[model samples]
Target: MSRPGSPVCTPDWLALREPADHTARACDLADRLADRLGAWPGARDVVVRDLGCGTGSMGRWLAPRLARPQRWVLQDRDADLARRAAAATPVPATAVVGDLADLDTLAGTDVLVCSALLDLLTAPDVERLARLCADAGCAALLTLSVTGAVALDPVDPLDDDVTAAFDAHQRRDGLLGPDAPDVAAAAFARHGYAVHRGPSPWRLGPADAALAEEWLRGRVDAACAQEPALVGSAERFLARRLDALGAGGLHAEVGHADLLALPGTVR
Candidate 1:
């Protein structure tokens, strides 16, 4: 479930920066998901529903490679993003403006894809979704969740406290709270979907200067918003990190899980 009125809470910095820079990382994660599932032996056409399909990033990455023509349904509450995603999709695709609670609107999809979305939902919501997917017999791909840890190049003492607080903030049950990958995996397991988890971290450095900067700014902004206590320090910390990146980009570890589950599979 999305936070009440928080659907639009997408940090401005992330909205502006992540689109292009995150493409490579998204593609790599998608490839890993595709390889894990391979071809579903019984399925002829693969129908994929990208839940929380922000600008159809996952669709852009995953559609071209399928042997069978893929039908993609990009679902998000944001109409503008839905329109943009519909326009960009290479395969047969449609966009739906609806919340995750309206996931029932989704039907007959072979794959249920939710990238960077699970972390935004509550645990119960995640479980409900898992059960729905199992009933529909759709495989799932959930990606790019914050693991609540940031490894700095020159380790900052405050790094641990800040990240931990941020993680706590993420897990807070305000409207939607933050549902981690572990919770999601367990939900899938309970629903009888064999779950496969892969950690795909965002590998950044000076080579990815633009993306790194965007990520840094977004991280700081999000951290501050989630934990207002850090607001005063976040900007300065973000600046320091950005400066270090000018010399050599910092490796920001973003913990992500690629969950692949088949219907009726046991733990």
Candidate 2:
């Protein structure tokens, strides 16, 4: 999924949104994942490989919650981010700079985890991942996949048009975009894995002014990229939304979902 010109995630952007991402994750899925893994108190053999582990936020949030001694294998295309994640993690950790397949990293992996990643993959890419995990006999916890739903408070007439454009942009070049989670579920099921899905929408308000501002800016930009004709209205819309956000009168509910696919039949 590494495209030559794909937007690389910036550290500042990742840090700014970490809290919201943490709060928005599906706790029930993690709890259920824990139950499936069972209580392995003091067991240090549990291995969690975090693909696209941006600054190790997933590990920091989920490791302690698992309540088990485990090792973390953080992978990222960015060398710096991978190194930072390995260093910051509070457990025995290692960073893989290149592709996991290059290192054969998944051979003994117990769980595969990804966040905000599926939306960037194609349907065939997800199928390949599911097939790989099934072949490797490991579980997967994929989260924060957009479902093409966005609700902005104090609705504006231009909202729907811009949203439609952005959704189209996300799916351009054959990426799954909002449909990734569902596509992933069906793929895993075909491989005999028990699948679970849950909501992980980001509910932003004044408290999230900074993140909301950045997100709105990027969204409008993407929408404009998808449809050049939307330039004028998108500009006006972004300005109005920024004003509302600054005035503390705006709230946005961005739709996202989490999926847990475990090997074997439904429990």
Candidate 3:
């Protein structure tokens, strides 16, 4: 279920409609993850199960780097997305249409991957998922969870409040209650999975004016709608930032945590 005023789960926002170059920017982040984690012995020859695999973005980013052949299973609740993802993914990829609640269906994967998805699940759901992955002996990589702040310029007095409200909006659904990255990492650690954490922040500037604008629009829309009191203030703030962007440009920080977990403790 989606949270009130949350943009993450919206169909259009979730869709793979970003400009090719913009999409590449996002994909580049995943590529960095592959480089960082692929060195582990367990990562090779592993079957990757991508949960909430929207348009096969993760697959597109990670497939080329594997030394051994990888079997990527792209799973999502949207059948159309699954179909499209299957079509778009490189060879050696499969698509499954289902929800995360069906842990039984997730069996047989060596590695579990979910990008920008943990923040959408409840605590129980996360716990259940960690246990399931542990049972399957699957290493997991979960990424791109929002940290709830975007610094386009110098900080303002209301920045903290805006970010707090947005975080509340993300957790209001009760299912995914807050910084899911942190929660999921802890759950995995408890289940005996040694997890390494990394940060992937989208640092936008004049070079990324277009992508920055798109992200800003989505973020402002969600923030204002979630807290009506911030509507006017958000607009004013966005206007000033956009103007600044015309010259000095603005930087919106899209903070995410990259988690790498294995079956055994790191030696």
Candidate 4:
């Protein structure tokens, strides 16, 4: 089940990063997931249920890559996003308006997928997700979980400070934050899935200034929000950042991780 987050997702923002997201994702993991699903005894007809299908980005990225006839089920907490995602997805899609909870009803999906979603859940929530997937004997391809590492070219004096604060903000509400990928892998492994992980970092360069600037603003804003004391220098740091970005001299490598889990091991 995909849960909503504070400010991690929005249609416009999701659309803006789609290209980078696809590029940053580890293609090997997707290919591996496709192979596992291909051999799945239950996949006479493949069903990919994207939990929290915001902007439908996950489906658009994954469906064609799979070598099986599939039906996309895009579920979202926002009804409009659900319907819009269903309509815009390249493949035929069905939209369901809701979150995936109530484990009793988690069956019927051949494969589970979600992008940038695991971090929004708690450890118990993640364990439950793994358990549910294992019980249903479904494979999962969970992608783009933040890894709490941001490297910026021409680093600033306060870059580490801002990143630390931003990460703290991510963990403020007991959320997994950058710890999601590891936690998810362990959870899946504990529940009898053979889990695989690979780095999916966004390597942004001069051409990605727009996205980089937007990412910088959000990262700084979240940092300042978590620790208001960073404001004075943060404002100054932000200015220099914008100036560098405007001059096309800025680059950043934002960290993320992707996970692929195929059932059947220690159950």
- TM-score of each candidate structure, all chains considered together: 0.82, 0.94, 0.81, 0.93
Candidate 2 lDDT tens digits, 19-54:
999999999999998887774445557799998887
Candidate 4: clashing pairs of residues: none
Off by over 4 Å in 1: 1-44, 174-179, 226-229, 265-267
How many clashing pairs per prediction, in order? 1, 0, 4, 0
Candidate 1, 210-261: lDDT as tens digits: 7778666766765677788887777778777878888784666555555666
Q: What TM-score does candidate 4 reach? A: 0.93
Better candidate by TM-score, 3 or 4: 4
lDDT of each: 0.68, 0.88, 0.69, 0.85
Query: What is candidate 3's TM-score against the reference?
Result: 0.81
What is the TM-score ranking, best to worst? 2, 4, 1, 3
- Candidate 2 vs. true structure, TM-score: 0.94
Clashing pairs in 1: 206-249
Candidate 3 lDDT, tens digit per residue, 139-185? 78776665554564656666676776666677775846347877888
**Candidate 4 residue lDDT tens string, 177-232:** 99999999999999878888999999998888878888888888989999999999
RMSD of each: 3.8, 2.3, 4.4, 2.7
The candidate, 2 or 4, that scores higher on lDDT is 2
lDDT of 1: 0.68
